[model samples]
Target: MKKEFRSGCPISSALDVIGDKWSLLIIRDMLVKHKKTFKEISDSDEKIAPSILSARLKLLESYKLIFKTKVPDNKKENIYLLTEKGIRLTPIIIEFSLWGNSNMREFNEIDDIEGLNSDKTLIIQTVQDNYNSMLLNFQ
Candidate 1:
């Protein structure tokens, strides 16, 4: 039998996969910084444990939010790529980052909120449009 969603709300369903703090941070690292490898992800300041990183990657893959492929030049290493479903999350992540930047004084010192917010709307729209185009290509 197929698994069921927790609810009919789209946001809730999205949260089911990415609501966790670590999961979103991982996605942020991927989308914002383009960090793909396990070592790169684990080395983030968040200090996610190796075991947890492995588990989260598996879970994200299971949810079809990410897919793993052998690195082009390194057969021994795998690179994680976001699926269309995952790419659709770009706006949500950006918004959260913007919100945090606005609310957290310390975060402001580290993040370039003026620059980020200046292009915030455009960035979200571009991501959505590009992701839609990618989905069409997949189809």
Candidate 2:
């Protein structure tokens, strides 16, 4: 499928790829929660439908944000993992988390909000290390 951009604006171009809420949430799951399978991701706090989860996973893969590979011991099962491009999104997610915590009272109640709200660099590095290590397995 062709990736159709709506305009020349950088923000618009970015939204064209990772614009949807579900897309970002999927990235969050992989980066923050280390969720590697469809079931794990679908069972996230948002509870996304299987059909929607399948489509979003494919879209993320097409955009080079994530990839799916067979489990070394179980060929029948596939695991979704972040690419370098996707790992790069960690900072953005951290920033968003911080912003939400600051402005939204409910956001402040999220699991481990205390840790997520402190020391942005630490959060970014921790997620990057987790994802890069996973990527090494595929490489």
Candidate 3:
């Protein structure tokens, strides 16, 4: 579906595009874990179905949250990279992760997220730098 807003409400607008669990999970994999390829995303612990994963990837791309590009020196392979819009979602994802970790035992904190969150500038810079490094490798 194209960028169809249910109303002028910001929350509903966002939910219309990325309210689904699969969408958020895919975003989480790319943003938090830096998963780039379809295979990498499929290998996540949640084990999402292949068909569903494919659809979510396409949807994210359509929403301009991510874009697909050919892997350098590998014409047959493509990788997903987050767009600036996606990068801006970093804080929201971090907060979401922290909230989940607070209640769930299985979802252990994997990174020093508390420290990252405490220092907003450092976290944003870290995410931007990481993306920049990944982009450099493709060039």
TM-score of each: 0.79, 0.89, 0.82
How do the residues 1-139 of candidate 2 rate in per-residue lDDT, one tens digit apiece? 4478999999998898888899999999888888998989999998889998998999899988888998788899999998888889888898888877677766446454547755789878987997788667765
lDDT of 1 by residue, 1-139 (tens): 1246799998888777777888999987877667778999999998999988998899899988888987766789888878877877898888887788778866446556445766878887766665555434323
Top-down TM-score ranking:
2, 3, 1
**Candidate 3 per-residue lDDT over residues 31-97, each given as its tens digit:** 7678999999999988999999998888889989999999888889999989888888777776676
After superposing candidate 2 on the true structure, give the runs of residues whose Cα lies further than 4 Å from its correct spot: 106-109, 136-139
- The list of candidate 1 runs beyond 4 A from truth reads 1-5, 106-110, 125-139
* Per-candidate RMSD, Å: 4.2, 1.9, 2.8
Give lDDT: candidate 3, residue 121.
61
